[model samples]
Target: MSSELPAFSWPTDPSLQPAIAPVPTERITPEWAWGGSTGLGMKVCIVDSGVDGDHRAIGGMLRGGAVVEETDDGVEVTEGTHSDLFGHGTACAGIIHSIAPDAEIYSARVLGKNLKGYGSTFVAGLQWALDNGMNVINVSMSTSKQDFAGILREVADQAYFSNRIIVAAANNTAVYSYPWLFSSVISVACHAEPDPFTFYYNPDPPVEFTAPGVDVDMAWAGGKRATGTGNSFAAPHIAGIIALILAKHPTLTPFQIKSVMYYTAKNVRTELAAAEEEKRDE
Candidate 1:
């Protein structure tokens, strides 16, 4: 059960540029018309470079134990380490935590020291997330090439069969990136401010949704701010949205959750129609 793939595009839209915004309380605040997401009691696994626990945006949101390892340099690094060296993972974790404040976060530091790593490390993290009972697994990484070894694909299938929801980042490039490229995971694209610029290079169901990513501002190391301009940032929003959805319907299977999200997405057809209209207008 998959949708046909769509063409891709990347445009310079001023309104789409990321700007300074609040700490993503819309997904959590009761005042929101969408209602607050009940991340309480649900545990989310954030598989990324790591998190800086002390960041104001993430303060008490950080939960779960650390998975640490020593780098070739002999430096010790911890999972949910609660500190960011490059700030990329922190920004991503902030988005997920902001939307699912009640949801406990389990950090899996697959990427270490600025996110330079091999595919095996990420695969290991994915397996770890499953074994530890992580209801939601957020993978904000991409592999340029698409290769499916028997065991890796089986692992993805096992997670799906076991009812674990995995969210992945669509590759920044026009080409598909794995595990987002893999049909088992939810692939997310970037949608930025004002004009709401969207980047959907892949047309398959894998590239299901889009969220704020462009010049979006988020917490960085040393109390600084960083702006990202890619789908990488957008993926967390989808992960966060999933957290909200799962909180409401705990019994939903991965397939059912994915279907409901697509069916209930705010103005999805309208947005796609509008995109086509704009293309015609151009």
Candidate 2:
């Protein structure tokens, strides 16, 4: 004599597809932007694979900073090229520069040559970025689990204390990812033409905002042009947007700026999702 129990399944309706909002045209729409342009002399730090400081798209954007980390000998790991050997970081930096042409980008090499590294390195990079007075920090990488939330809160707290903002790439999977999942941080989702030929896709929820990710044309290492995927490519878009927001609303707190983005985002997904739902119901 067992009791019946109900089962649960994730939303399957096509209408539930993550909708993507179109990139903003105003260069600044979040009321925060009333303060100024994205770059406007603000400094942003990108903690990921190193960036190629010589890339054309990054001409004036690269900050040309050095990485300082503790080594086996207790000395700082400071020797290495600033070049983004894997091309991932350089691409992220390019997107940031495009939106905030005046913002300077500083890269902290944490992922190493393979574009992979330890959580310790990521933390170390954050410390470096903060110590360097970065106005915004873009973290494009994540760990295997959603455990980085606390660390993100701590970092965001420190940045907040210093009047800086920390933006991160939302995980690519359907599940949650760290730093991005941390409510204290601004989590940016990837958005672009699903098919290279298509214009764009509907926006996704739980995602605070969207940026160019799919088929996104950008700069690469060795002065090359390339296209690729990943939330890594999307984080910088928010970073740049935040910079512009700060430039305009110099008095707005990082938290307040984030709020403005949510309310001001051009929600192209809402209607798209409704139409898809009607079709499904029919």
Candidate 3:
């Protein structure tokens, strides 16, 4: 006997339309965005060399992680706890942890001990993060290869539509890079500022934000600490802040979160001065 499949149908007229709750404030401020948020329930994935769970800076906040390896059958992602091949991933994790200590951090180690890896491996790691229900993905490294551009764009678009935010770092040099160049991701670069919480949103295209990256102290592998500077470090600062926002407003989509960031950005806050004044008058 043949069995009938369940019917799949769209909502009828009486069905309520999908909608997000309106933000209570007319003007988005830092206080309104993530003032007291501790990033309690957010899941952040760092796609990099790897993350050292034992690092002091991590503070035992790592939930789990995966390692992407190259085998005869192509790329393989093994899920479990992993160590940072290089210190890059640990540094990124430290930044995010410092900003959002309560958020769960997971690592997708794609790079090798040399701090480099194949583009295909990077893609696989990113795909792993997307499939594993990561709320935010920190991509401090990017591939400049033209062959991977199409796939990277596709993945970035998927993250955008899936309510998963990908905070990418722009290349430190003048060279080009994938994913970060896409509008679907939040691209960040290094600023000379020392304050981690002080970030600026650029009005230009591609690079949308700037965060502290110069001489920033970070958690290194082997239970040590180090200072470094690069766009790589900058991306996690934004990623951490994004975690805070997601923690407070769990229902918000990626685009809505970006709008909130734009409004609360250090540079953009001046434009909201008039709005704040108007609100005070009421």
The number of the candidate with the highest lDDT is 3
For candidate 1, lDDT tens digit of each residue in 105-205? 77777676767766666677778788889888888886664453455567778889999888888788877557776678787887655232222333446
Q: What does candidate 3's lDDT look like per residue over 1-282, in tens digits?
A: 645435764354455556546765455788888999999999999999999998889889999989999989999989999889889999999999999999999999999999989989999999999999999999999999999999999999999999999999999999889889999999999899998889998987779999999999999988889999999999999999999999998988888988998888887787678777898999
Regions of model 1 farther than 4 Å from truth: 1-34, 68-82, 145-149, 194-206, 269-282
Tell me the lDDT of candidate 1: 0.69
Better of 2 and 3 by TM-score: 3
- TM-score of decoy 2: 0.75
TM-score per prediction, in order, is 0.73, 0.75, 0.90
Clashes of each: 11, 13, 0
lDDT of 2 by residue, 166-277 (tens): 8878788876666676656677777764421111222455566666677778888788999787777877877887787777666667766665665455563345457769
Q: lDDT for model 2, please.
A: 0.71
lDDT to native, each model = 0.69, 0.71, 0.92
Residue pair clashes in candidate 3: none
lDDT for 58 in candidate 3 is: 87
